[model samples]
Target: MKKYFLKLYQYNYWANKRVLSALTSQNVSDEKILSIMGHVVAAQYLWLHRIQGLPPAEVKLWGTYNLPQLVSMAEEIGTRWLQFVESTDNFDRELTYHNYTNDPYINNVENIMIHLVNHSSYHRAQIALLLRQNGFEPINTDFITYDRVITGQWKD
Candidate 1:
């Protein structure tokens, strides 16, 4: 199960980097796309902090961040997640945290990790759509695509 989650997180990190590269390479300056990416970065940090039993206020869940800042944050958080997942032996370990509305809830580590990946995918889809609507070609960010690249089945 830890291996499975680690793969998911690796895919997440890869997909995000591809998206960021596509946008940056084209010099995209769309505000909506930037905002969504910022949100993704913020959410990743928030979830990791929550899993580590940190206070919710330590990271802003919807903070505004520029693309360079977001790229840095994503890289740092990706490393942290990889390390955490590698070191953790108990995915069922439960954590207690408050929602944005201050409502409290408890969840296990596995579910939180799953939620983080799904949340990023949701926002990434939105960014892809926005890029297409604005006459830009969005990069392919599907899990199978990442798998092919990682397994040497696909070439750049």
Candidate 2:
């Protein structure tokens, strides 16, 4: 399960980088992509905040930044998330905690990690679909592909 989480995190990091690359060389206004990416970042922030039992921070409003700004935001968020994973001890994975909304949640570290990955994956898929509808060819974003890229192994 820990390996799965790590693989997913690595995959997400590369997939997001690809998306940011695709955002370049397109004639579409920055507003379109930036807005979508902002939502992804905001969602992660909200969930992380909730898990930490903290109030949600004010999210950056959409249509407020250029493509570069959005890319930078994604990079920063990604770096922080990876750092959090790195700092977490193995035993902590099973610890439980409540969300900011006071909802009962399995504070198990593994579940929370999975939630983060799934949440980001959901939003990235949405962004890809939006890009396709807008005539931009969405990049191939597959876990297997990411595995190969990061680990140099094509294990099935």
Which candidate gets the maximum lDDT versus the true structure?
1
lDDT of 1 by residue, 1-156 (tens): 988988999999898888998988888888889889988878888888778877663555666667888788888888888888989878888888887778999988889889989999999999999999999999999999999999999974
Candidate models: Cα lDDT each: 0.86, 0.66
Q: Which ranges in model 1 have alpha carbons more than 4 Å from their true place?
A: none
TM-score of 2: 0.73
CA shift at 87, candidate 2, in angstroms? 0.9
- For each candidate, what TM-score against the reference? 0.94, 0.73
Clashing pairs in 1: none
Model 1 has an lDDT value of: 0.86
Candidate 2 residue spans exceeding 4 A from truth? 30-33, 50-55, 60-65, 90-107, 153-156
Model 1 lDDT at residue 29: 84
